[model samples]
Target chain A: MSLELRGLSRRFDNAQALRDIALQVDGGEFVALLGPSGSGKTTLLRILAGLDFPDQGEVRIDGQDMAQVPARHRRIGFVFQHYALFRHMTVFENVAFGLRVRPRASRPPEAEIAARVRRLLERMQIAELERRLPEQISGGQRQRVALARALAIEPRLLLLDEPFGALDAEVRKGLRHWLRALHVELGLTSLFVTHDQDEAMELADRVAVMQAGRIVQFDTPARILDQPANGFVAGFIGQAQRFAGRLTSQELIFEGLPLAPLPRALLLGEAAAGAGQGPAEAFVRTHEWQATPGPGNAVLRSARAAGGRVQAVFAVGPALIEAEIPPGLLEPGETCQLDPLTARVFLADTPFATG
Target chain B: MTPRPAIAEPRWARIVLCVLALVLLGLFLVLPLAAVFTEALRRGWGPVWQALSDPDAIAAIELTLLVAAIAVPVNTIGGVAGAWCIAKFDFPGRALLLALIELPFSVSPVISGLVWVLLFGAHGWFGPWLQAHDLQIVFALPGLVLATLFVTFPFVARTLIPLMQEQGRSAEEAAATLGASGWQTFFRVTLPEIRWALLSGVLLCNARAMGEFGAVSVVSGHVRGETNTMPLHIEILYNEYQFVGAFAVAALLALLALVTLAAKALLERGGPRGSLAA
Candidate 1:
């Protein structure tokens, strides 16, 4: 089933937890809600699961309005960071509980329930722990049981709130792959929330990058990493270092240092044309810079240095100037010539240092 | 050869500290109990059992345990529901409701008893209406139960509030998303998570109820064979100069308290054993 949320908002007494959030997931698609803590990614997931009701907006599942539906009636499966297994119940009983408690129309017979639970336990690779209470199992195994229980109901959608967050680094890596395979096997629409960039990139079909209660960019992982919507998205999604600069005609200047050629589209208006080059910023990949000697073509700036090695620095103008050099080629006081290969530029209205 | 070492504290300091500790312990806890037990045992063990086996005293013991059994569970449910409501829900007067629940803990047991008596006595507000319905409360079994319930109500609720507050709403919401109905979520997920804490609260409530003499005595009217509890029975023996019998009843109550304390320790040591998933 497809799921959609529009203009979802919630506010606590002290702070706004979520605001004007809108998103949709196609059937059988796996989406990751990626954001830092307090960014409202979990809040958004809870709203979709019907565990939380948004102060505004509506949730629709496969064309059915879910705003009025209770969480159980919505047929959504939510897996928590903490596995949340029923500690007092055996693994088998915990898995079977969801089905056993269903209304008569949806309830399976005792034999069928037992069979399903057994099959699921086997599928989850925890069959040996069927009779063992949750307290007897390890954290990772408990998470698997929680998943098996949630899947036992055959839900229309699945929501995972940092499912592997509680596990150690090694266990988290293993569960991510296992979850990907499970999603394929079940063919259900799923949304997993996490702040780990690598996990989101590896696990989701689409990565929705969120910051401060808003989705800054939502696209395939590769596209988001390669071409972010803005400097925030770029810095957030991947390892592109930023710098401060100003735009000139076909060039960006940083701290009185002229950078390499800028994209024609970026060089617009008075600021781009250098009328009020004013303040600007730029971002460049570390690999995008080249080392050279002397003021060569495309060289942005050259500074004085000691020893035989000179320190040359190039600016992408909208960003900062960076240099590439051989190991021990230039000491702290040495200088080298540099040039930038590509520049993603941003405008800053006031003069300031780049960090 | 070098000297081996000097102790952390001088020998005289150590001896003085130990004696001080012993003296404090004796004055606060050991002395009174020893005095009571020695005086009672001197009268011979025969009279102690005779007083304990007295039909009225026996009845009082039975009634006290019965009341505790009923009240503990009722308050357990009440405590959990109350804790959940205060922790997880927001509405007007919530703070006030919380304050009111804690009133029992701060209010003198005698005052608590007086409040119940004022409400259930013949000249009290609900007395005539209750009498009209042929329901007895004042100086009756229900009055004794009411007084005991009032004094012990805070035990479970107060114990549970902090625990419930510490355990957040994420787990319950997670259970709900897993297709568990509200009741199933509570029984399977929420209840199990809080089981040990709830049990401790219940035990504490039971212990307090057993020792709840002031409130119960005021409303029970100390009827010889009807409303008197174990504590009241002990009081009756002491008043009749049957010190040995009083100590016997007190010893039995102490044993119950010890059992409750031991169970509490075991449950606590278990330490949320099966509660974690990852």
Candidate 2:
């Protein structure tokens, strides 16, 4: 189902959880609500699932107002971060709960429920664990059971709140494919909430990057990586180091380092008409710079080969800048000049540059 | 993670503490319980059977069972409902309400019994109206049940609150989001989770209801056959110097307590011990 939120606002005594939040999800799209903790992404997901109500604003599912709908009737499946599976129930029983709870007239027969639960467990790759309780299974298996349980009701929209947050990394990577495949096979519109940017970037079709109860950017991961919406997004998205600089509409220059001036066009998304360059900051990732042999003030502190690339750190004056450059560029402690020509410096024009 | 050496302590001190604990328990608990059983059987089974089969003893037993039957379930319902309200929701005066639920625990049993008297006694607050209306509460079965209820009021709710709070309502919310109605969520997901704690609480509440004395004494008015519970019956027999009768009834009460404790222990075995410890 297509989902839309308009001007949603939720306030607690001391904090505004969500403020005038507006979001739209096209049918069958996998959208990630990416933000730091306390950013209201989870609150927004709860409101969408009818587990929580907004103080002000409308939640519409397929253009129908959900104001009068209760959570049980919404048919919007929600997977908790901790995988709130019934600890006492076996995997089979947990998955069948949604179907068995239906009204007598609508409830499936016992044989049908069993078959359906088995099929869902198999699809979750946990069919053999049907007889085991949740506590007996691994974290990843528990999450699969939780997902299978949520899906048993045939919900059109699935909401996962850090579904893999409780699992370790190796298991998390394996399960992401299962969720994406299920989303595609079921053609369900899924909204996933996570603070892990890599998880969001790897899984989401489009990510809604939020800060302080507002969506700062809503775009594909590639666009968000290349063109951050604001200073916050620029700092939040990539693991980029910050260097205070001045942009003069022609080129960018750093304060302490005597590096070559960067042309204006290299600072991607910073060329808004008349974007003044006084007291600005630039975000540069490790791979954005190149090292060419030269006798310069910058010293090549160390270089290491990693993942088929040369990962090295340079001591440029008092600051340490990491760069992923061409292999055999420079030996350790060698003087080399930085070539930020192919580098895409994410520039934040604002003075409050957190990056 | 490997085993470590125990903290070194003087062997004499450890032996002293262990002996002290055993001696204290033998003097205070094991000795008295054994005395009750031994004294009851000292006159042999013949007199003990006669004392147990006495009309007054039989009536007291019936009354005690009836009171527990009425009070246990009433308190169970109230306790579970109160616990659900306190643990599952936040509202104004929640702390105050919680404190009030535990009020009986803090207040003396006599005071709690006196409270009912003040509310329903013929010479108490509503006593005159109740007497004029020919409605008997104090010095009757209702009064006895009310006193027992007052003393055991906190058992189930106190047992449930900490556990419910810790387990949380996430599982219930998950069930609701999966299309289970509120009642369905409770019965299928929530009830099964808390069943062990509930059973443990019931055992304790039942044990207290059967053995309550101070509160029941304040309101029972010592009506020999009608109002006296098991403990009160034993008290009256002891006062009349009927050692055999009193000891027989005391042995029965002790057995009941032991049975309840065993049940509670079994329940603890089946679930987290900390849940029942609350």
Candidate 3:
């Protein structure tokens, strides 16, 4: 199913949970709604599943308006964050729920239901746990059973709200790869919500970065990393050091120091034209800034080895900027020149300001 | 091996608290229970059995069981519906509705029966109309059922609301997305999740319905063989100076109470599986 959401908005008392959001996922494509907590990603996913209705707008699946369709009629398989498996049911019974609950006219035979459940359990590698209650299995196994249960009905679209959110780090990592492979194998249109950027980037064909109540940017992971639409996307998708600076006469100034030449076309573009050239913010990822020993440069305040790499924190005026450096390149209290290899500069008045 | 941690309280303090609890239990619970059995069997098992097998006493026992059978199931269904509304849906006046459901528990049982009498008695609001229609509500079976129903109304709902609220709506929503209807979701997901709590509530309701004295007494008109419940019957026998008979019947009620207590404990210990066990 090709999912499309247009002009979606929801409000809870004084807070706007979702606002004028729009997104699209092609058939058999995997998309991730990526955001921090309370960013309206979960709300958007719920609206798609018909579990929640948007205050205003339309959800269309393959050109059919879903406003009048109830959740049961949507045929959208949803996996909750905590893997809401029935506590009393065994793994096989939980997986067979959707099939068994079907209206008798369309329901499959008993033998067929059993065969399908067995096949799914085997495919999910949880055949041994078929007779075990959900509480008797590991969290990871429960997650698989949840997925198998959702898949039992052969839904047209799969919606997962943090499918691996409750598992341990090691288990989450394994499931991420497994889910990616499963999406490919099943060829089902899927949309998953997650706050983890790494998981989104690794698993999704495209990532829709949400903030507050809107979709801020929607693009491939590579594009989202290399060419973040604004400062928020740049800082949110990766470890970025933000500099409160401004664009002055074709030069980017950081703390009254001219750091690099700003692209002339970008400065003259519509984004900067609205701000009227007062002040701007720049976001530079850890690897985007190059640091080398030099005179009259930012002083290195600290150095620590992290994840098989060296991370050095530099004190540039009152601001602290972190950069990834090679081992043994910089020591604490040493001076180093900082150069921006890449940066995303947005006007201070823009909503994309990280601060 | 690691050394065990010290107890939170001092040893002397723990012993004092334990002794105090045991003393209270003995003075109030054990003494009363022992007195009932000792006094009932004072005339031996022959009189005790004869008192229980008396026609009026037998009628009271049958009437108590019948009332419980009717009242418990009715309240169980009502309570489940009320809990489903209060727990699953958010609407205007939800708090007010919950307060209404619990109104009977807070009101005096005498007041509960009096309210029914006021509605259906001779000079009360609905009395003239009821008399004109030749329908008897007060001082009848309907009045007794109503009083019992009102008093036990909150038990099942009160037991379920907190539990269902804690479980939340995620599982039901997941079931809906998987193509289960509202009824199917309730039966397959919601019911199983709350089965033990529901059973516990039903047991409590049944116990209260069977043991109810104040409300049933007010509404029963003391009609010995026809309207009197077990508790009312025990009171009549005691007031008539039939000590052995009253104590025998009291022993039966006490046994029922114990059975209710045991069932409640069992249900609580073996309640729904913990959602986060794994």
- Reference-based lDDT, each prediction: 0.77, 0.87, 0.87
Candidate 1 local lDDT, residue B77: 82
TM-score for candidate 1, please give it.
0.82
Worst 10 residues of 3 chain A by lDDT: A264-273
The sequence of per-residue lDDT tens digits that candidate 3 reaches over residues A127-221 is 99999998889999999999999999899999999987899999999999999999999898899999999999999999999989889988999
Q: Is candidate 1 or candidate 3 better by TM-score?
A: 3
Please write out the lDDT profile of model 2 over residues B44-148, one tens digit for every residue: 999999999999999999999999999999999999989999998889989998999999999999998999899998769988988888999999988998899
TM-scores for chain B, in order? 0.87, 0.94, 0.95
Cα lDDT of model 2 by residue, A245-353, tens digit: 7778688787788778777766665543356656666778887887778887678888889988988899988889888978887898889877665333434534322
Q: What is the C-alpha lDDT profile of model 1 across A269-298, one tens digit per residue?
A: 224433544456666665566666444333
Clashing residue pairs in candidate 2 are: B121-B127, B122-B127
TM-score attained by chain A of model 1 = 0.81
Instruction: Tell me how candidate 2 scores on lDDT.
Output: 0.87
Better of 2 and 3 by TM-score: 3
Query: After aligning candidate 1 to the native by TM-score, how far in Å is the CA of A136 from where it should be?
Result: 4.3
lDDT, candidate 1, B1-278, per-residue tens: 98746766887998999999999999988887677667667778887788789998898898899878877888878878888899777789999989989988899989988987789788898989998998888787777778888888877778777877767786677666656678877877778777777788888898988878898888888888788899998899889987788888887777788789898878777756532211
Residue pair clashes in candidate 3: none
DockQ of candidate 1 compared with the true complex: 0.60
Ranking by TM-score: 3, 2, 1
RMSD after CA superposition, every candidate:
6.0, 2.8, 2.9
Better of 1 and 2 by lDDT: 2
